[model samples]
Target: MKRRKNIKTVIYHGSIWIIGLLMIYPIFWTIASSLKPENEIFRNSASLIPSIFKWENYAQGWQGFGGLSFSTFFLNSGFVTTMVVIGTLFSSALVAFGFARVKFRFRTPLFVCMIITLMLPSQVTLIPQYILFHNLGWVNTYMPLIVPAFIGGTPFFIFLMIQFIRGIPHELDEAAYMDGCSTFGIFWRVILPLTTPALATVAIFSFYWTWDDFMTPLIYLNDTKLYTVALGLQMFSDPSSVSAWGPMFAMSVASILPQLLIFMFFQKYLVEGITAGGVKG
Candidate 1:
């Protein structure tokens, strides 16, 4: 019996390791390809080992093109991502508080509308949003990327916060209110502090989404100098000419560092937030 149990454990762990490797192989390939000479990239694509370690790919990629270094792209992404995360946290928390705590007319209908928006595909609204931004003189600028977040543009984040807030005891709010704390005070002083896990989850998600967003930046940013890392990576590829695969892969690896680091550090909070929100109070 013990031998059978050990065999089962071995099979289970072996399957898990194999699947993990299969999933992570692409990332490993990208890192390996980045270190290989351009000629060897596609030639030996299947192999994780490179014949020559061309560390120069990082240097070349960082040099960028059009007189703007990759630093500019990084700075642009950093700024947009920072603003979006801040805006999302602030707006989602405030809006979630209202829906979860406050009693108001038409609140249920409004909440239903917000949930409906969550189900709506973003592609459906893309054209209309573009036209509206263009009409508002937001084209070719970061405004289109950053402003909507301040207004609770991502309904999913609001919904997540609302669920998390609902899990909190109402007695806390009542206690605060009995002490003469206004609604806003109860939210700011009492509720916000307790929702740290959910907030971290939201911040991490917002950062990841905003940083990795390519379509929005591609559509709005025409100027090379104003490009984010996603757009900057595109600049490496020109169909009419030979593409810089090595440098592109190198920068692709670089682009994901922030996300990897954030996940590594705050992954606990992310899991906690997700689980807590999933359970009703």
Candidate 2:
């Protein structure tokens, strides 16, 4: 029995390592390729180590085309992503709090409508959204990307927060009310503090989605100077030919750092948040 159990444990650990490596292989390949000379990249694609490391990829990629460097693109992405995180946190928390706590007329109906919207695909409303933004003269600007978030935030975040808040006891609300706490005060002082894990989850998700968003930025932004990292990565490649693989790979590696760092820093919070938001709430 002991031998069989030991064998099973070994198999489980080995399988986990294998799966982890398989998942990380693409990222490893990108970083390895970034260091290789352009000609050597395809030749040694299967290998994780480059025969000759060309350090110019980072320099070339950051130098960028035209007068604007990658600094501008990074700045633009940072700004948009920051605004999106803030907006998603505030708006989603407020909306979620209302659904979770407050009694309102037709609240269930409104929540159902929000759920329906969640099922609706972005592709379905793409054309209408574009037309509306164009009419509003929000084209070639960050307004289209950032403003919608402040208005409502994502349904997923709202729902997650709602579930999280529901897990909080209603007695707290009653107690706060007894202390002459208003609805807003209860939310701000009590509910908000208790929902930290859920909020962290929302912020992390919002950061990733906003940072990796490509199609929306591509559609709205025509100016090269206003491009985000996603758009900037695409800029390294041209359709006509003569694409810079080395530089593209370099930028791709750089683009991953922010997400990797966020996960590393918030690893505990993320796990707690997801677990907390998943089961009870």
Candidate 3:
């Protein structure tokens, strides 16, 4: 029995290491490729380690194609993502509280409808939404990207929060009521405090989604000044002109750093949040 257990453990550990390597290989390749010169990028006989390191790619990428600097793109992405995360978290949390705690005649049906929205692909509504934004003269602005989030635009976040909130005991609400707490008071004081883990999960997910969103930004933002990292990366590519592989790779690396830092900092809360939600019910 002891030998069998040891063998199983070793197999499991080996499997985990293999999976980790599989996941990390792409990132390693990207970093390695970023160090390689343009001439060596697609070389048939090129080594994994570049014969020479070109650190200047990062600087060139920052400066961007022609006069456009990546600093502007970074600022745009940061501002839009920050607003979207904040808006989504606050809106989704408030709506989830209503769905979880408040009673209404059409509550279940309304939630069902919201879930149905999740089933509908964004592509189906993209043209209509674009037209609406254009009619409102929001085509060239960040408003189209950031404003919808405030209006409970993320049904998935609401659903996730609702599930988490549902797992909280009704006894807690009753206890708070006995202490003279109103509905809003209970939510703000009791529920919100207890739901921090779930909230953190929502916030992190929202941040990552909004930060990486490319299509919406591309469609809405026309001015060069309003470009995000996603669109700015495209400036590195041209069909008529040769693309700069080195600078583009450096820029890509730079774009990923902030998200990496955020995940590293908040990853602990994600596990805690999921575990708490699981056990609470």
Candidate 4:
């Protein structure tokens, strides 16, 4: 029996390592490819390591393909993504607090409706939303991409936070009230402090989502000056000729570095937040 148990544990551990490698291989390949020379990119017998590293690809990609600079795109992406993360975190936390703590008429129904929004595909609403923004004179601006975030654009984040908030014991609120705390005071002093882990999770998720968002920025930003990294990557393509593989790979590598750093820095909080939320309500 002990031998069978040991065999099962070994098999499980081996399977997990294989899955981890499968997931990590693409990111490893992208970084490795970014360093390869253009001539070696598609070579039939090329190894993972480049014979000569092409660090100049990053510089070239930063300059621009032909007309526009990627530095401007990076700035635009950073600004928009930062705004989206801030908006999503603040708005979702506030809305989730209301659902989790406050008693009100039709609260359950409203929460259900909010969750229903998550089920609708963005493609279905794309045309109407575009026309609305066009009529509002926001079609070619960052407003369209960043404004909805302030109004609880993501229902899933709100729901995740609500679940986490619900897991906190009601006794804490009652104790705060006994100490002469108002509802707002209890929320500010008690609930928010205890929810740091969940908020970190939401912030990280929002940052990544907005940073990688391509479709919305493509539709809303018209001027070359206003392009995000995702949109700017398209500049590497030459409709009349071959694309620049080295620069494109370099840009892709650079674009993901911020998100990777953020995850690494806040990884502990993210795990605690997720696990704490999983506690029975």
Instruction: Give per-candidate clash totals.
Output: 0, 0, 0, 0
- List the candidate 2 regions with Cα displacement exceeding 4 Å: 239-243, 271-281
Q: List residue ranges in candidate 3 displaced over 4 A.
A: 1-19, 44-47, 239-243, 269-281
Q: How far out, in Å, is residue 147 in model 4?
A: 1.0
lDDT of each: 0.90, 0.88, 0.84, 0.84
Point out the higher-scoring one by TM-score: 2 or 3: 2
lDDT, candidate 1, equals 0.90
* Model 4 residue pairs with clashes: none
Model 2, 1-281: lDDT tens digits are 99999999999999999999999999899899989899888985778898878889999888777777888889999999999999999999999999989999999999999888877889988899999999999999999999989877478789888988998999998999999999999999999999988888989988989999999999999999899988987775665533678887887888888999999998887787667656754
Worst 10 contiguous positions by lDDT, candidate 1: 234-243
lDDT of 3 by residue, 71-181 (tens): 888998999988988898889889999999999889999988998996789999899999999999999999999998998887877877888899899999999999999
| Candidate maximizing TM-score | 1
Ranking by TM-score: 1, 2, 3, 4
Per-residue lDDT tens digits for candidate 1, residues 205-237, read 888899999999999999988999988877755
TM for candidate 1 is: 0.94
TM for every model, in the order presented, reads: 0.94, 0.93, 0.88, 0.87
Candidates' RMSD to native: 1.8, 1.9, 2.9, 2.9
Evaluate model 3: give its lDDT: 0.84
